[model samples]
Target: RIIEGYDGLGIVSTIDPGQGLVVVWVTPDTQDEVTHILHFFPRALNY
Candidate 1:
């Protein structure tokens, strides 16, 4: 549930549903990068 919210951000390196834990690696270092990520994955932003 938690990771789903960050669907457009980055990769999920690790997850523990029981503990409600999630690790994400977002690499949007610049404005353009962030725009690209959101552009490519529009559904993620809606979530």
Candidate 2:
């Protein structure tokens, strides 16, 4: 929901729910911003 709040920032997609795998796609212009925002999230296994 937090990422959803930002317009055109990025999107989080579930790749494998069972393994808790996901992907985040961010706009080139918003890469830095997205990186900053992502810093707040808990680090995932093998990330």
Candidate 3:
């Protein structure tokens, strides 16, 4: 939800709901922006 809020940034999908696993498909040229956003998120992402 948070990642998707950023336009042209990325789209997140659930890989395993039970394990809280998900994937973020980021757009080309937006890696830095996405990484920055993820860094400040409340929940830590397992990259």
Local distance difference test, each candidate: 0.52, 0.77, 0.85
Ranking by TM-score: 3, 2, 1
TM-score of 3: 0.83
Q: List the candidate 2 regions with Cα displacement exceeding 4 Å.
A: 44-47
TM-score of each: 0.33, 0.70, 0.83
- State the displacement of the C-alpha of residue 15, model 2, in Å, after optimal TM-score superposition: 0.5
Q: Per-residue lDDT for 1-47 in model 2, tens only?
A: 66788978988798999987777788779889977877787764333
Across 1-47, the per-residue lDDT of candidate 3 in tens digits comes to 88877887987899999998999987669888998988998977776
Better of 2 and 3 by TM-score: 3
Candidate 3 RMSD to the correct structure: 1.2
Ranking by lDDT: 3, 2, 1
